[model samples]
Target: MSALLQQRSTGAARDDARLRDRLVFGDETAFIDLYERFSSLVYTIAARVTRDRRAAEDVTQEVFLAVWQRPLAFDPAKGSLRGWVAMMAHRRAVDLVRREEAHRRTTLDGRLHAEPLGHGDPVGDQVSDADAAERLGTALRALPEHLSRAVTLAYLEGRTYREVAVELGVPEGTAKSRLREGLRRLAVALQSIHAQDGEGP
Candidate 1:
Protein backbone atom coordinates (compact mmCIF):
# COMPACT_ATOMS: atom_id res chain seq x y z
CA MET A 1 0.00 0.00 0.00
CA SER A 2 2.90 2.36 0.77
CA ALA A 3 4.49 1.56 -2.60
CA LEU A 4 1.18 2.22 -4.33
CA LEU A 5 0.84 5.59 -2.53
CA GLN A 6 4.37 6.54 -3.59
CA GLN A 7 3.54 5.74 -7.23
CA ARG A 8 0.42 7.84 -7.07
CA SER A 9 2.40 10.76 -5.66
CA THR A 10 4.95 10.48 -8.45
CA GLY A 11 2.17 10.35 -11.04
CA ALA A 12 0.55 13.47 -9.59
CA ALA A 13 3.87 15.32 -9.75
CA ARG A 14 4.32 14.35 -13.38
CA ASP A 15 0.77 15.48 -14.16
CA ASP A 16 1.40 18.81 -12.44
CA ALA A 17 4.55 19.26 -14.55
CA ARG A 18 2.58 18.57 -17.73
CA LEU A 19 -0.13 21.00 -16.69
CA ARG A 20 2.51 23.67 -16.00
CA ASP A 21 3.99 23.08 -19.44
CA ARG A 22 0.56 23.47 -20.98
CA LEU A 23 0.09 26.69 -19.01
CA VAL A 24 3.34 28.07 -20.45
CA PHE A 25 2.00 27.14 -23.87
CA GLY A 26 -1.25 29.08 -23.20
CA ASP A 27 -3.63 26.20 -22.64
CA GLU A 28 -6.93 27.29 -21.03
CA THR A 29 -7.51 23.97 -19.27
CA ALA A 30 -4.08 24.16 -17.71
CA PHE A 31 -4.80 27.70 -16.54
CA ILE A 32 -8.09 26.62 -14.98
CA ASP A 33 -6.38 23.75 -13.27
CA LEU A 34 -3.69 26.01 -11.96
CA TYR A 35 -6.29 28.40 -10.61
CA GLU A 36 -8.13 25.58 -8.93
CA ARG A 37 -4.91 24.42 -7.30
CA PHE A 38 -3.78 27.82 -6.05
CA SER A 39 -6.87 29.98 -5.55
CA SER A 40 -7.24 29.04 -1.87
CA LEU A 41 -3.57 29.62 -1.21
CA VAL A 42 -3.83 33.05 -2.81
CA TYR A 43 -6.94 33.89 -0.85
CA THR A 44 -5.29 32.86 2.41
CA ILE A 45 -2.37 35.20 1.82
CA ALA A 46 -4.69 38.03 0.80
CA ALA A 47 -6.79 37.50 3.92
CA ARG A 48 -3.72 37.84 6.09
CA VAL A 49 -2.91 41.23 4.57
CA THR A 50 -6.38 42.69 4.00
CA ARG A 51 -7.79 41.27 7.22
CA ASP A 52 -11.16 40.94 5.59
CA ARG A 53 -12.62 37.77 4.16
CA ARG A 54 -14.54 39.46 1.33
CA ALA A 55 -11.54 41.55 0.29
CA ALA A 56 -9.41 38.45 0.36
CA GLU A 57 -11.87 36.79 -2.01
CA ASP A 58 -11.74 39.82 -4.28
CA VAL A 59 -7.94 39.78 -4.27
CA THR A 60 -7.96 36.07 -5.06
CA GLN A 61 -10.27 36.56 -8.02
CA GLU A 62 -8.25 39.51 -9.28
CA VAL A 63 -5.01 37.57 -9.02
CA PHE A 64 -6.41 34.69 -11.07
CA LEU A 65 -7.92 37.04 -13.62
CA ALA A 66 -4.53 38.70 -13.94
CA VAL A 67 -2.91 35.31 -14.39
CA TRP A 68 -5.38 34.38 -17.10
CA GLN A 69 -5.00 37.70 -18.83
CA ARG A 70 -1.23 37.57 -18.87
CA PRO A 71 -0.44 33.89 -19.09
CA LEU A 72 2.36 34.57 -21.54
CA ALA A 73 4.18 36.62 -18.96
CA PHE A 74 4.79 33.64 -16.69
CA ASP A 75 8.38 32.59 -17.18
CA PRO A 76 8.86 29.00 -16.07
CA ALA A 77 12.63 29.46 -16.15
CA LYS A 78 12.48 32.22 -13.57
CA GLY A 79 10.24 30.55 -10.99
CA SER A 80 7.72 27.80 -10.44
CA LEU A 81 4.10 28.55 -11.35
CA ARG A 82 3.05 28.41 -7.69
CA GLY A 83 5.76 30.86 -6.72
CA TRP A 84 4.70 33.27 -9.47
CA VAL A 85 1.06 33.11 -8.38
CA ALA A 86 2.05 33.60 -4.74
CA MET A 87 3.99 36.72 -5.71
CA MET A 88 0.97 38.11 -7.49
CA ALA A 89 -1.19 37.42 -4.45
CA HIS A 90 1.32 39.19 -2.20
CA ARG A 91 1.42 42.23 -4.45
CA ARG A 92 -2.35 42.52 -4.57
CA ALA A 93 -2.59 42.19 -0.80
CA VAL A 94 -0.01 44.92 -0.29
CA ASP A 95 -1.91 47.17 -2.64
CA LEU A 96 -5.08 46.63 -0.63
CA VAL A 97 -3.30 47.55 2.63
CA ARG A 98 -1.74 50.68 1.14
CA ARG A 99 -5.07 51.83 -0.30
CA GLU A 100 -6.85 51.24 3.01
CA GLU A 101 -4.21 53.10 5.00
CA ALA A 102 -4.34 56.06 2.61
CA HIS A 103 -8.11 56.32 2.95
CA ARG A 104 -7.96 56.15 6.76
CA ARG A 105 -5.30 58.84 6.89
CA THR A 106 -7.24 61.05 4.52
CA THR A 107 -10.62 60.85 6.21
CA LEU A 108 -10.01 60.17 9.92
CA ASP A 109 -7.39 62.78 10.67
CA GLY A 110 -9.84 65.16 12.32
CA ARG A 111 -11.72 62.55 14.30
CA LEU A 112 -8.48 61.22 15.79
CA HIS A 113 -7.60 64.70 17.00
CA ALA A 114 -10.39 64.67 19.61
CA GLU A 115 -8.79 63.92 22.95
CA PRO A 116 -10.15 60.97 24.91
CA LEU A 117 -12.65 61.90 27.58
CA GLY A 118 -11.35 62.01 31.14
CA HIS A 119 -11.61 58.98 33.45
CA GLY A 120 -14.21 58.55 36.26
CA ASP A 121 -16.98 59.44 33.84
CA PRO A 122 -17.69 56.17 32.15
CA VAL A 123 -21.43 56.68 32.02
CA GLY A 124 -21.15 60.25 30.72
CA ASP A 125 -18.46 59.23 28.28
CA GLN A 126 -20.53 56.36 26.93
CA VAL A 127 -23.56 58.58 26.54
CA SER A 128 -21.51 61.27 24.83
CA ASP A 129 -19.98 58.75 22.47
CA ALA A 130 -23.37 57.32 21.57
CA ASP A 131 -24.83 60.78 20.92
CA ALA A 132 -21.88 61.74 18.75
CA ALA A 133 -22.19 58.57 16.74
CA GLU A 134 -25.89 59.10 16.23
CA ARG A 135 -25.46 62.70 15.10
CA LEU A 136 -22.67 61.74 12.72
CA GLY A 137 -24.85 59.03 11.24
CA THR A 138 -27.66 61.50 10.74
CA ALA A 139 -25.39 64.00 9.04
CA LEU A 140 -23.92 61.32 6.80
CA ARG A 141 -27.40 60.21 5.80
CA ALA A 142 -28.31 63.76 4.90
CA LEU A 143 -25.44 64.17 2.46
CA PRO A 144 -26.08 63.97 -1.28
CA GLU A 145 -26.20 60.36 -2.36
CA HIS A 146 -22.98 60.45 -4.37
CA LEU A 147 -21.10 62.31 -1.68
CA SER A 148 -22.46 59.95 0.94
CA ARG A 149 -21.31 56.96 -1.09
CA ALA A 150 -17.84 58.45 -1.50
CA VAL A 151 -17.59 59.05 2.22
CA THR A 152 -18.76 55.55 3.06
CA LEU A 153 -16.43 53.93 0.58
CA ALA A 154 -13.46 55.92 1.76
CA TYR A 155 -14.06 56.00 5.50
CA LEU A 156 -16.09 52.90 6.22
CA GLU A 157 -14.52 50.53 3.73
CA GLY A 158 -11.11 52.21 3.86
CA ARG A 159 -10.89 52.36 0.09
CA THR A 160 -8.47 54.85 -1.46
CA TYR A 161 -9.97 58.14 -2.73
CA ARG A 162 -8.74 57.25 -6.19
CA GLU A 163 -10.43 53.86 -6.03
CA VAL A 164 -13.63 55.44 -4.69
CA ALA A 165 -13.53 57.95 -7.51
CA VAL A 166 -13.05 55.19 -10.03
CA GLU A 167 -15.91 53.14 -8.58
CA LEU A 168 -18.23 56.15 -8.45
CA GLY A 169 -17.24 57.51 -11.87
CA VAL A 170 -16.13 60.79 -10.31
CA PRO A 171 -12.86 62.72 -10.37
CA GLU A 172 -10.25 62.00 -7.72
CA GLY A 173 -10.56 65.57 -6.47
CA THR A 174 -14.30 65.12 -6.20
CA ALA A 175 -13.78 62.07 -4.06
CA LYS A 176 -11.37 63.93 -1.81
CA SER A 177 -13.73 66.91 -1.49
CA ARG A 178 -16.68 64.71 -0.70
CA LEU A 179 -14.73 62.93 2.03
CA ARG A 180 -13.46 66.21 3.44
CA GLU A 181 -16.89 67.80 3.45
CA GLY A 182 -18.59 64.76 4.84
CA LEU A 183 -16.05 64.55 7.65
CA ARG A 184 -16.46 68.25 8.45
CA ARG A 185 -20.22 67.84 8.63
CA LEU A 186 -19.88 64.77 10.81
CA ALA A 187 -17.51 66.59 13.13
CA VAL A 188 -19.83 69.56 13.43
CA ALA A 189 -22.79 67.35 14.09
CA LEU A 190 -20.90 65.42 16.76
CA GLN A 191 -19.80 68.65 18.40
CA SER A 192 -23.36 69.90 18.49
CA ILE A 193 -24.49 66.69 20.08
CA HIS A 194 -21.78 66.91 22.71
CA ALA A 195 -22.61 70.54 23.44
CA GLN A 196 -26.29 69.67 23.88
CA ASP A 197 -25.32 66.91 26.27
CA GLY A 198 -23.35 69.50 28.31
CA GLU A 199 -20.12 67.74 27.41
CA GLY A 200 -18.54 71.08 26.39
CA PRO A 201 -17.49 69.65 23.02
Candidate 2:
Protein backbone atom coordinates (compact mmCIF):
# COMPACT_ATOMS: atom_id res chain seq x y z
CA MET A 1 0.00 0.00 0.00
CA SER A 2 1.00 3.62 -0.54
CA ALA A 3 1.98 5.79 2.41
CA LEU A 4 -1.46 7.34 2.54
CA LEU A 5 -3.14 3.96 2.47
CA GLN A 6 -0.81 2.68 5.16
CA GLN A 7 -1.66 5.59 7.37
CA ARG A 8 -5.33 5.03 6.77
CA SER A 9 -4.99 1.37 7.58
CA THR A 10 -3.24 2.18 10.81
CA GLY A 11 -5.89 4.72 11.75
CA ALA A 12 -8.60 2.22 10.95
CA ALA A 13 -6.95 -0.36 13.19
CA ARG A 14 -6.89 2.10 16.03
CA ASP A 15 -10.50 3.00 15.50
CA ASP A 16 -11.41 -0.65 15.45
CA ALA A 17 -9.84 -1.13 18.84
CA ARG A 18 -11.74 1.84 20.18
CA LEU A 19 -15.02 0.61 18.71
CA ARG A 20 -14.61 -2.86 20.13
CA ASP A 21 -13.95 -1.48 23.57
CA ARG A 22 -16.92 0.87 23.38
CA LEU A 23 -19.28 -1.81 22.12
CA VAL A 24 -18.17 -4.28 24.76
CA PHE A 25 -18.98 -1.66 27.36
CA GLY A 26 -22.32 -0.72 25.71
CA ASP A 27 -21.44 2.86 24.91
CA GLU A 28 -23.72 4.30 22.21
CA THR A 29 -21.72 7.51 21.95
CA ALA A 30 -18.62 5.53 21.10
CA PHE A 31 -20.52 3.76 18.34
CA ILE A 32 -21.66 7.07 16.87
CA ASP A 33 -18.13 8.37 17.05
CA LEU A 34 -16.93 5.30 15.22
CA TYR A 35 -19.55 5.82 12.52
CA GLU A 36 -18.51 9.41 11.98
CA ARG A 37 -14.89 8.42 11.83
CA PHE A 38 -15.20 5.57 9.33
CA SER A 39 -18.23 6.51 7.27
CA SER A 40 -16.13 8.20 4.59
CA LEU A 41 -13.82 5.24 4.23
CA VAL A 42 -16.76 2.87 3.84
CA TYR A 43 -18.41 5.20 1.34
CA THR A 44 -15.22 5.49 -0.68
CA ILE A 45 -14.92 1.71 -0.93
CA ALA A 46 -18.58 1.31 -1.82
CA ALA A 47 -18.42 3.99 -4.52
CA ARG A 48 -15.30 2.43 -5.99
CA VAL A 49 -17.01 -0.93 -6.27
CA THR A 50 -20.55 0.14 -7.17
CA ARG A 51 -19.70 3.21 -9.29
CA ASP A 52 -22.78 4.97 -7.96
CA ARG A 53 -22.63 7.76 -5.39
CA ARG A 54 -26.10 7.22 -4.04
CA ALA A 55 -25.68 3.48 -3.81
CA ALA A 56 -22.34 3.87 -2.10
CA GLU A 57 -23.89 6.19 0.45
CA ASP A 58 -26.62 3.67 1.10
CA VAL A 59 -24.08 0.92 1.58
CA THR A 60 -22.12 3.02 4.02
CA GLN A 61 -25.25 3.64 6.04
CA GLU A 62 -26.05 -0.05 6.08
CA VAL A 63 -22.57 -0.96 7.29
CA PHE A 64 -22.87 1.35 10.25
CA LEU A 65 -26.33 0.04 10.99
CA ALA A 66 -24.98 -3.48 11.13
CA VAL A 67 -22.34 -2.39 13.57
CA TRP A 68 -24.96 -0.79 15.75
CA GLN A 69 -27.25 -3.81 15.59
CA ARG A 70 -24.58 -6.34 16.42
CA PRO A 71 -21.95 -4.45 18.32
CA LEU A 72 -21.31 -7.32 20.64
CA ALA A 73 -20.74 -9.79 17.85
CA PHE A 74 -17.47 -8.22 16.76
CA ASP A 75 -14.72 -10.36 18.25
CA PRO A 76 -11.65 -8.24 18.76
CA ALA A 77 -9.38 -11.28 18.99
CA LYS A 78 -10.21 -12.46 15.48
CA GLY A 79 -9.78 -9.14 13.58
CA SER A 80 -10.05 -5.39 13.72
CA LEU A 81 -13.48 -3.79 13.45
CA ARG A 82 -12.24 -1.73 10.52
CA GLY A 83 -11.31 -4.85 8.62
CA TRP A 84 -14.69 -6.35 9.26
CA VAL A 85 -16.43 -3.20 8.07
CA ALA A 86 -14.25 -3.03 5.00
CA MET A 87 -14.98 -6.65 4.21
CA MET A 88 -18.69 -5.98 4.42
CA ALA A 89 -18.37 -2.98 2.11
CA HIS A 90 -16.44 -5.02 -0.41
CA ARG A 91 -19.07 -7.79 -0.41
CA ARG A 92 -21.88 -5.33 -1.07
CA ALA A 93 -20.02 -3.87 -4.00
CA VAL A 94 -19.59 -7.32 -5.55
CA ASP A 95 -23.25 -8.10 -5.14
CA LEU A 96 -24.17 -4.90 -6.96
CA VAL A 97 -22.01 -5.89 -9.93
CA ARG A 98 -23.37 -9.44 -10.22
CA ARG A 99 -26.94 -8.22 -10.24
CA GLU A 100 -26.10 -5.79 -13.02
CA GLU A 101 -24.48 -8.45 -15.21
CA ALA A 102 -27.46 -10.76 -14.86
CA HIS A 103 -29.73 -7.91 -15.91
CA ARG A 104 -27.61 -7.09 -18.96
CA ARG A 105 -27.51 -10.71 -20.09
CA THR A 106 -31.26 -11.10 -19.77
CA THR A 107 -31.84 -7.94 -21.79
CA LEU A 108 -29.48 -9.09 -24.54
CA ASP A 109 -31.17 -12.46 -24.70
CA GLY A 110 -34.56 -10.84 -25.15
CA ARG A 111 -33.31 -8.48 -27.85
CA LEU A 112 -31.69 -11.36 -29.72
CA HIS A 113 -35.07 -12.92 -30.45
CA ALA A 114 -36.03 -10.04 -32.75
CA GLU A 115 -32.63 -8.90 -33.97
CA PRO A 116 -31.90 -9.45 -37.63
CA LEU A 117 -29.13 -11.87 -38.54
CA GLY A 118 -27.27 -9.20 -40.48
CA HIS A 119 -27.49 -5.49 -41.20
CA GLY A 120 -26.39 -5.67 -44.80
CA ASP A 121 -27.58 -2.30 -46.10
CA PRO A 122 -26.82 1.20 -44.82
CA VAL A 123 -30.45 1.74 -43.83
CA GLY A 124 -30.55 -1.64 -42.12
CA ASP A 125 -27.31 -0.90 -40.25
CA GLN A 126 -28.56 2.42 -38.98
CA VAL A 127 -31.89 0.94 -37.91
CA SER A 128 -30.23 -1.97 -36.19
CA ASP A 129 -27.74 0.23 -34.34
CA ALA A 130 -30.45 2.56 -33.16
CA ASP A 131 -32.59 -0.35 -32.00
CA ALA A 132 -29.68 -1.90 -30.13
CA ALA A 133 -28.78 1.32 -28.33
CA GLU A 134 -32.39 1.96 -27.43
CA ARG A 135 -32.81 -1.52 -26.10
CA LEU A 136 -29.70 -1.25 -23.93
CA GLY A 137 -30.66 2.12 -22.50
CA THR A 138 -34.19 0.97 -21.77
CA ALA A 139 -33.00 -2.14 -20.04
CA LEU A 140 -30.60 -0.19 -17.83
CA ARG A 141 -33.18 2.38 -16.90
CA ALA A 142 -35.86 -0.18 -16.15
CA LEU A 143 -33.91 -1.81 -13.32
CA PRO A 144 -34.95 -1.02 -9.77
CA GLU A 145 -32.54 1.18 -7.86
CA HIS A 146 -30.83 -1.75 -6.11
CA LEU A 147 -30.60 -3.86 -9.27
CA SER A 148 -29.40 -0.91 -11.31
CA ARG A 149 -26.78 -0.23 -8.64
CA ALA A 150 -25.54 -3.82 -8.80
CA VAL A 151 -25.23 -3.65 -12.58
CA THR A 152 -23.38 -0.36 -12.47
CA LEU A 153 -20.93 -1.73 -9.91
CA ALA A 154 -20.30 -5.15 -11.45
CA TYR A 155 -20.29 -4.35 -15.17
CA LEU A 156 -19.31 -0.71 -15.18
CA GLU A 157 -16.75 -0.82 -12.37
CA GLY A 158 -15.57 -4.41 -12.89
CA ARG A 159 -16.26 -5.76 -9.40
CA THR A 160 -17.76 -9.06 -8.22
CA TYR A 161 -21.15 -9.67 -6.58
CA ARG A 162 -19.58 -10.95 -3.36
CA GLU A 163 -17.76 -7.66 -2.96
CA VAL A 164 -20.98 -5.80 -3.64
CA ALA A 165 -22.94 -7.75 -1.04
CA VAL A 166 -20.33 -6.99 1.60
CA GLU A 167 -20.37 -3.32 0.82
CA LEU A 168 -24.17 -3.25 0.75
CA GLY A 169 -24.47 -5.25 4.02
CA VAL A 170 -26.85 -7.70 2.39
CA PRO A 171 -26.78 -11.47 2.12
CA GLU A 172 -25.37 -13.22 -0.94
CA GLY A 173 -28.85 -14.38 -1.85
CA THR A 174 -30.06 -10.79 -1.78
CA ALA A 175 -27.27 -9.81 -4.09
CA LYS A 176 -28.18 -12.60 -6.51
CA SER A 177 -31.83 -11.60 -6.41
CA ARG A 178 -30.96 -8.03 -7.27
CA LEU A 179 -29.00 -9.19 -10.30
CA ARG A 180 -31.62 -11.66 -11.43
CA GLU A 181 -34.50 -9.25 -10.99
CA GLY A 182 -32.62 -6.44 -12.69
CA LEU A 183 -31.85 -8.66 -15.66
CA ARG A 184 -35.44 -9.80 -15.97
CA ARG A 185 -36.57 -6.19 -15.90
CA LEU A 186 -33.96 -5.28 -18.49
CA ALA A 187 -35.26 -7.97 -20.82
CA VAL A 188 -38.78 -6.66 -20.53
CA ALA A 189 -37.63 -3.11 -21.07
CA LEU A 190 -35.63 -4.03 -24.15
CA GLN A 191 -38.63 -5.77 -25.66
CA SER A 192 -40.75 -2.73 -24.94
CA ILE A 193 -38.21 -0.40 -26.49
CA HIS A 194 -37.91 -2.58 -29.57
CA ALA A 195 -41.68 -2.66 -30.02
CA GLN A 196 -41.85 1.12 -29.65
CA ASP A 197 -39.11 1.49 -32.25
CA GLY A 198 -41.30 -0.34 -34.80
CA GLU A 199 -39.40 -3.61 -34.46
CA GLY A 200 -41.58 -6.68 -34.03
CA PRO A 201 -40.47 -8.40 -30.84
Whole-model lDDT per candidate = 0.64, 0.62
Deviating ranges (above 4 Å) for candidate 2: 1-15, 102-201
Worst 10 residues of 1 by lDDT: 108-117
Clashing residue pairs in candidate 1 (N, C-alpha, C atoms within 3 angstroms): none
Point out where model 1 deviates above 4 Å. Answer: 1-17, 24-26, 102-201
Tell me the tens digit of each residue's lDDT in model 1 across 14-105.
65567766866778887778777887668755764565667788999999888777776766556456668888987787777777765423
Tens-digit lDDT track of model 2 for 74-154: 766576675677788777765765677554222222222123424442111232335556567556655566788776555
TM-score versus the correct structure, for each prediction: 0.42, 0.44
Q: 87, model 1: CA deviation in Å?
A: 0.5
Give me the candidate number with maximum lDDT. Answer: 1
| Top candidate (TM-score) | 2
